[model samples]
Target: MCGAVKFEVHGDFDSFYLCHCRYCQKDTGSAHAANLFSQSARLVWLAGEEAVASFTLPGTRHQKCFCRTCGSAVPNTHIPGLLVVPAGCLDSELSRVPTAHLFTSSRAAWDHALGDVPEFSGLPKAT
Candidate 1:
């Protein structure tokens, strides 16, 4: 992101989820975090490795890495056998849609019934 960090995923993802845990919402600055999990995917940093920074929550398994230039989330190793890819960081197409929403109890109060919201093809014109 920010034209500095780029990467490639070398294997297929096995699962995808939308996480609504507090940490995820805070990390993503949104209602939830979309993540692709893979047991065999290899993350190959194509550029700006030096700009990659990571943080793990204290006393927790939640960890994240991001691009220093734009604070864009990037892939990071997960649980020794898996790779966590932020769906937004992927430049290519995904094989499948998110299978579930995790930690729904912690979803934002304003995030309910989103399917009813108006859809826009692009930026809505200013009223």
Candidate 2:
């Protein structure tokens, strides 16, 4: 994880997901991205908020923000206390968290499916 920004989780995660959505792929410049969804209070930006840059894709709520200095994606608040943070940015151990894969149908053919995790064609109805 990049050290440009520090973060802490203030509450339990609602869910963690590996997204294969086209928007995520483009934003991450990767085959897929893992995201942790929780209340915005769960995210504590210890540094670098001033260096954050954001872009919103046309026709969708797929907004993304990143640190300009290190080019690491940062959490974007969705509501007063809700946030979606990229798992790749965590400094603590992440192995205990389980992530379900979403938007599997949009995943690149070259990317293999993750073992055993539940996969969804789209966001889960409950989410």
User: What is the number of backbone collisions in each predicted candidate, taken in the order shown?
Assistant: 0, 3
> Over the stretch 1-127, how does candidate 2's per-residue lDDT look in tens digits?
4577666768667788888999888888888888888763466667776788888888987888788887888887744566887887776777646468889899987688557678889888984
- Quality of model 2 by C-alpha lDDT: 0.77
**How displaced is residue 22 in candidate 2, in Å?**
1.1
Q: Which candidate is the best by lDDT?
A: 1
Instruction: Judge candidate 1 at residue 78 and give its lDDT.
Output: 47
Candidate 2: list runs displaced more than 4 Å.
78-81, 113-127
Candidate 1, run of 10 with poorest lDDT: 74-83
**Mind giving the per-residue lDDT tens digits that candidate 1 earns over 1-127?**
6879888888888999999999999999999999999998888988898998899999988899998989999888646988988998888877688989999999999999889999999999999
What are the clashing pairs of model 2? 10-42, 40-81, 40-82
Assess every candidate by TM-score: 0.93, 0.77
